[model samples]
Target: MKTKVNEISIKYQGNFKISQAPKISSSVNAAELLYNTWNKDQIGLQETFKVVLLNNANKVKGIFEVSTGGITGTLVDLRILFAVILKSLSCSVILAHYVK
Candidate 1:
């Protein structure tokens, strides 16, 4: 006789709210949006990978920091990014990275 093994499960906490304000119509708009969220003083100190989730209306559904690291670059776990996208039910995504 053998015991059963538990399957892997994914869970999302907190809130995933969809916003209608300030839709991303172009690359400039997207850049402005991301720039506003980044910290000015820390932008040149390290690297941070981020993912912006967009709904069908091109509105921002969510922003997730995929990873952070030293001055050069950061390691991103694709699984986490995909999980966030799946949980947010986003139709599109913008991947951005800040480097020193």
Candidate 2:
């Protein structure tokens, strides 16, 4: 008899076309992109960590929030971080954190 097992799947979805995604050539470009995507209301209230997922061409795949915490700090799990990068099939990544 075969035992029941859980099946796992990973997916990445983007609302916009890849060609329309902005390309990142410099740290400034990435900061601008991340800044634009950040939630303005939460910028000062808490600490949050995010990852900017990029394609081989350095175009954005998406931004994934790794964790959120109190005003002072947040935690980032390497396992979860890698899982998101692997699942999204990102070629490279930029890490960002916000703190007031």
38 in model 1: Cα distance from truth in Å? 0.5
Q: Residue-wise lDDT of candidate 1 within 1-100, one digit each (tens)?
A: 9999975544434464545356899999999999998888888898999998888899876678889898877899999888888877889999999885
- Please report how far candidate 2 places residue 2 from its true position, in Å: 3.4
User: lDDT of all the models against the reference?
Assistant: 0.83, 0.90
Q: Tell me the tens digit of each residue's lDDT in model 2 across 14-90.
A: 67899999999999999899899889998999999999999999998888899999988899999999988987889
In model 1, residue pairs whose N, Cα or C atoms come closer than 3 Å (at least 3 residues apart or on different chains), thus clashing, are none
User: TM-score for each prediction?
Assistant: 0.79, 0.88
Clashing pairs in 2: none
The backbone clash count of each candidate, in order, is 0, 0
Q: How far is candidate 2 from the true structure (C-alpha RMSD, Å)?
A: 1.7
Could you list the CA RMSD of all candidates, in the order they appear? 3.6, 1.7
